[model samples]
Target: MIEAQGLTKKYGDRTAVDGISFTVHPGRVTGFLGPNGAGKSTTMRMLLGLDRPTAGSVMVNGRSYADFPAPLREVGALLEARALHPGRSARDHLRWMAASNGIPVRRVDEVLDLVGLPDVAGQRVGGFSLGMGQRLGIAVALLGDPPVVVLDEPVNGLDPEGIRWVRTLTRTLAAEGRTVFLSSHLMSEMALTADHLVVIGRGRVLADCSMPDFIAEHAASYVRLRSPQQAEVAALLRRNGLEVTDVDGELHIQGRDAASVGELVGRQGLLLHELTLVRSSLEDAFMTLTAASVEYSARQQTPAGALR
Candidate 1:
């Protein structure tokens, strides 16, 4: 497990990270979400002991990262997939990293196969494609078989198949009771992969909750209905104190779920054509929650003036 309490970071006069606290527990995948420059990378750096926090503390397992005798064995991180030497072969790269951390060379091959890079293990990293480079980075992170894994944009250059593989890999790691903290900007992928979410905006903790709870709290969920007696059904719903909106001849009922809406319509003897509970999507919820927190927003440009 990873525990961060009042973590903060500063660079000169600018504060990169505010005091934020969140816990990443074992047996689940926790997604770290934020827009660019929201201090996500800074927080990960501090967690790995790459950068010193201006205030507060972060612990991997039960102690600070620096306190571990074998840091790599306690936490495996893939912060930057291209942080390897271009001239070194994938095998050589892993071999050296394992040697430095006192890990067995055989473990290198195991991770290579685990990441499906065994065929290119002897190829130079400079000649590898973007996806291949990402695979190598993953292999490096898994080299120590650490219980805590922190990955930043693990699917950056991956194809659809590679993305699916990564999703399964992270889930499997969590299923094995390992603590998995994955950071990515892909909301659709996160929705599929993460069991929990930790959303940060402008260096502050915007939300920390389960996936379903986050969506329900931040975005609107409503029941959509279509009926031959559309006008009557809408009027009835409104009189019953439910807010209803008509769009393209369909009624969107708010403040009630599908079952309640259906029951109300049935009791009124209204024949319904369609009814669906439209739960807010993860992307929708994220946009709504972070609308005000976006650092760089593009303003709409007015077309050439025609009048006034």
Candidate 2:
């Protein structure tokens, strides 16, 4: 498990990270989310002991990251995949990392195979593609067989197959009782992968909760219906004290789920063509919750001859 209490960071007059506290438990994947310049990078740096916090502390298990004799064995991290010696072979890089922490030399090949880099293990990292570089970095992280893994944008630059591999790998790690802390900008992928969430805005922890709770609390849900008798259906629903919005030819309703709405319409003998429940996606909910916290906003202009 990882815990941060009143974690803070500062740069001259700028406060990059405010006092933030949260816990990342084991046996599940906890996703870190924030918009650009929300201080996510700084917070992660503090967690890994790459930067000193102006106040408070962040600890893996029960000790600071720097306190471990073999830090990689305690906390395997992939903060910056490209921060490596470009001229070194992938196998050489892993070998050096293994040697630094007294890890067995054979572990290098194990991690190389685990990250699907054994075929290109002898290739220089400078010539590796972005995706291959990411894989090599993952191999370095797993070389020590750490109990806790922290990955930021692990799927960045990965193709569909590579992305799926990462998803499965993270799940497998967590299932083995390791604490997995992941950060990614892809909301769709995060929704599918994360069991819990730790959302930040302006350096403060905005939310730390389960996936279902976060979505249910921040997202909107409504019943959508299309009927041959549109006018009667709208009137009936309105008279029944439900909020209804008509767009084009469809009626969007609140205050009831699809089944309840369907039952109500059926009891009134209304002929319905379509009825379904529409819930806002995780992206939608994130946008709604972090609207004000977004570090940048742009004014959109319609192009000439654009469709309405």
Candidate 3:
């Protein structure tokens, strides 16, 4: 297990990571998520002991990474894909890492095969494609057969096949009782990959919960109703103390259920053309949660008939 107690990092006048504390447990994939520049990478760096925290500390298996008896055997990480020497072959790279940890040279071949890079093991890493490089990086991480694994944007440049491979590989590792803490900005991917989530905004914890609970809490649900008397139906729904938005002649009602909406329309004797419930997606929930802390918000779309 990895525990971060009030881990805080400040660079000059700017605070990169606030006093955020969370635990990453074994046997599950915990996703570290936030918008770009939201201190995700900084926090991961502090967790790996690459950067000194201005306050607090992170412990891997009840000790700081450097304090662990065999750090590589206990904790393995892939902070960046191209971190390896460009001139070295993928096989040679893992071999050196194995040597550092006093691991058998055959263990290097096992990890290369584990990451499905056996054929390209002899090729220089500089000539590897982005997806191949990511695979090679993962191979290095698994070379030590660490109990705790941390990966940052492991699917950054993979094709669909490569992405699926990573998804299966991560799940398999977690299933074997390893601590998998992964970082990614892809909400859809996280929805599929993560069992738990640690969400951050402005270097602070926004949420730490199970994936299902996070969706149930943060993702909104609404009912869409359309009627010939659109404006009247909207006003009626609004009068019931529900928020309504007009979308293409449909009334999108918030904070109300479908059965309640149906009853309301029935009581009003309104002839409805359509009424459907829509659930906000995980992506939408993530965006809504991090919007204010988003370093770059996209340009707002103007309503129809606005001044051009």
| Per-candidate clashes, comma-separated | 0, 0, 0
lDDT of 3: 0.89
Residue 199, model 3: lDDT of 93
lDDT tens readout by residue for model 2, 1-308: 99999999999988889999999999999999999988899998999999999999999999999999998899999989999899999989898999899999999999988888889999989999999988988887788899999999999999999999999999999999999999999999999999999999988888999988899999988889999999999999999999999988899999999999999999999999999999888898889889999988887887877855
lDDT of 3 by residue, 5-95 (tens): 9999998999999999999999999999999989999998988889999999899989988777657788888989898898999989888
Give each model a TM-score.
0.93, 0.97, 0.89
Q: What does each candidate score in C-alpha RMSD? A: 2.3, 1.6, 2.8
- For model 1, what is the error of residue 138's alpha carbon versus the real structure, in angstroms, after optimal superposition? 0.8
Least well predicted 10-residue stretch by lDDT in candidate 2:
299-308
235 in model 3: Cα distance from truth in Å?
Answer: 5.4
Candidate 2 local lDDT, residue 216: 91
Model 1 ranges off by over 4 Å: 267-269, 300-308
lDDT of every predicted structure (CA atoms) = 0.94, 0.93, 0.89
> What clash count does candidate 2 reach?
0
